[model samples]
Structures are given as C-alpha cells and as structure tokens.
Target: MIGKRVLSQEPVTLAEVKELTEAREKEGELTYEQTLTMDYCNKFAKLDKKKAEELIAEVEGLEKLSRRHAISLSDLLPSNADEIKLLFSKEHFVLSDEEISKLLDIVGKYKG
Candidate 1:
C-alpha cells in the first residue's frame, strides 16, 4: 500500500491491418468485398467474438454510454448499516477483529 502505479493520459494506438477491417465495416457502409472480407474475418479470427460483433452494431451511442455510469453505490446504502455488517467477510482472509476493523476503516475512505 506504500506506492501505486499510474497510467499515461494518451491512449496507445493498436496496429491497423486486416483485423481493423471489421471495425471500419461497423463504422460505415461496407462494400461487397468488405462484407465478404468481414464474414471471412469473423469465421477465422479467434478473438473477442461477442465484443467484436457488438461493436459492429454499436453506433456512437454516447447518450446511453454517458448515463450508464451515472448510478452510484451510495444511493443503495441505508442510513443504518447494521444490516450489512460483514461487507466482505468471505473475500478477505483476515486473522483478527482488529485487522478487519482497520481494513473497514481504510475502505471507508473510498466514497465512490
């Protein structure tokens, strides 16, 4: 817990090849050759098939994307938390009550 890693602001570019042809098809109108190529690519490629297929149909649906992460966990919490006593009892292998209380105290700082 003394240190943490961080990511750079700029995104790394993926290699553009025959693989990205499907992504281009998803973006706009696909030519006859492009359609045939996409079909072949989908048949042979051993990649994230579900995600790739979903991405093909998913337009620039920012309105839905923007609201997707709007819901907050704090909204579901009750004023009294005794009902949810052991939030992560099975997740961790703590040895003592003092250690568990310390863990909870540290976890309390993360609001969202």
Candidate 2:
C-alpha cells in the first residue's frame, strides 16, 4: 500500500461497483474487502451497468443535482417523493414539488 495516492475521486453507482468487482474476479481473486463489496453490490444493485449509466445521465440533466446525487438516485431509485427527499436530506437546498415529481417520473421509467 506504500506510495499509493488517489489520482481522483468520483461517485459510482452500485451497478458500476458490481461491474468492476466482477471484472476483478475474472482476472484473479479479489481481496477480502473487495469480496465483501462484491457481495453487497450483488445483493443491492437495482439496475445493471447499462441501465444505471442511462439513469445517471438522465438524472444529471436535471437542475440542482450533482453527479453524486445522480449516482445515488440511479443506485436507489427512490420510489416516492418522500424517499427522494430522504435521499437529499443532507443537502443544503431542498427540492421543489415539481422537481420531486420529475425525479419520481424518471425513476419510474427506469424501474420498469
């Protein structure tokens, strides 16, 4: 682990995590933490990689949402306005009713 440095940091959805871990597994054995992460992603990832990417892209198009929010939305696909609000609870700004409806509609499209 010596001399390891993070070149950059970015948010990733569970589906992306699953994709990466699966690739690592195919190459060789995963470390213990990676195995645990793979298990978690397998159990909770709601969408596959392609769908997740699409969802992230669409979500990112909305105003006031960051890449982190897009990834979180794509990963959880919150069912209702309340759930969506819960996801954004820590943010300084609040989502309007219109925005919440928009988010729900987009999420519903992907859920199907």
How many steric clashes between backbone atoms does each model show? 0, 0
True-vs-predicted CA distance for residue 60, candidate 1, Å: 38
What range of 10 consecutive residues in model 2 has the weakest lDDT sum? 51-60
lDDT of 2 by residue, 1-112 (tens): 8999999998888998999999999999999999999999989999998998888899889999988999999989999999999999999999999999999999999998
User: Which regions of candidate 2 fall more than 4 Å away from where they truly are?
Assistant: none
lDDT of 1 by residue, 27-67 (tens): 89988887787676555443243432333223113222221
Q: What lDDT score belongs to each candidate, Candidate 1 first?
A: 0.36, 0.93
* Candidate 1 segments whose C-alpha is farther than 4 A from its true place: 1-18, 47-112
Clashing pairs in 2: none
